[model samples]
Target: MSVIGVVASATGGVEQLREGLVRPLLDREHQVAITVTPTAAAWIAPAERWELERITGLPVRSQPRRPGEARPHPPIDLFVAAPASANTVAKLALGIGDNQALSVLSEGLGSTPMVVFPKVNAAHARHPAWAGHLDTLREAGVVLVEWELLEPRTEAKRELPWDRVLAAVDGLADQFFQGRLRDRGAGVADGGDG
Candidate 1:
């Protein structure tokens, strides 16, 4: 199974993450590790941290990993930030790793396929700085997972669909598998399990 590192930020749509994103990954037999921003953790009513841990079977990280720690962050084939707030997105664009979620994103910037499902409100999205941040991420090879940025509160939050993200990851996983198979084939053909 492919492993996906999911970063959930503090946003209005954050509460829907488990059902919208994590459950689909589980159904697809993909392993998921979630890192919730400290602000998001607090925003979640009744605190779904324990529930998420149970569902994912991995500790839900909410703090940055200490340097030289014996244990390290779980390895993953892909990275995603869902319900990413304007603040989180901006920090990531600026390469700020001050928080756990952003730190993971910073590490995955180039090596891993990264997608961010932003949930910016009209007011925030219209800010002049928002465009610069997005541009920075684009230059860094990060894909901004987007849905219709319509008027907010008029309807349910229309962030990038979780299914869309899953489909994208599936394609990435296929590429990864094919690459590995090619490497293995090359080794075997060389008269060694290289």
Candidate 2:
């Protein structure tokens, strides 16, 4: 089973954990692990964590592991950051991994297939640095699933669009695996690359 890492930031997307990610991963018989930002962990309800743990059977972590500590989660093949915050996007693109969630995301950049849903507000979306960061991420093969434009709303979830985020990541991961298999087959048939 493929292992997927779900990183949640302190935004409305955190609210979509179970339905948008956990259940879908479980339904696919994939193993799921979660890492949250410190503020994001505080945003989660205890009942939510209990339900997620029940499904994943993996402890959710928000802090970096101490030196020599056993790594609790498996190395992920696919990574998704939903409700990704502006802070998260900038740090990821700039190679700043000050938190557990960001570190996981940064480490997965090229090796692991990644999908990021930035929960940016209209004001932040207009910032000059915003487009550049997104550009850098897209250049690195990080797919971005953003909300369809509409009249601005104050409610956060309206901007988050977890459903779209989930679908985008699934489609991207499928494409990634298909390409990998095709490449491997071609290499074998051609008697390797020399």
Question: After superposition, which runs of candidate 2 have C-alpha atoms over 4 Å from their true positions?
Answer: 149-153, 156-160, 183-194
On residues 1-194, what C-alpha lDDT tens digit does candidate 1 reach at each position? 77888899988778888898988888889889998899987887655777888899888888866788754446878887887888899999888988889888998897787878788767777888899998888888777876666566775645457777667667776777689789999999999776
Query: CA shift at 9, candidate 1, in angstroms?
Result: 0.2
Best by TM-score: 2
**lDDT string, candidate 2, 117-162, tens digits:** 8877777788899999999999999989887443356643443566
Ten contiguous residues minimizing lDDT sum, candidate 2: 150-159
Q: Can you list the residue pairs that collide in candidate 1? A: none
Q: Where does candidate 1 have its weakest 10-residue lDDT segment? A: 151-160
Off by over 4 Å in 1: 66-73, 151-160, 191-194
lDDT at 11 for candidate 1? 81
Q: Relative to the unseen true structure, what is the C-alpha lDDT of residue 152 in candidate 2, on a scale of 0 to 100?
A: 50
Highest lDDT: give the candidate number: 2
Error of 2 at 59 (Å): 1.0
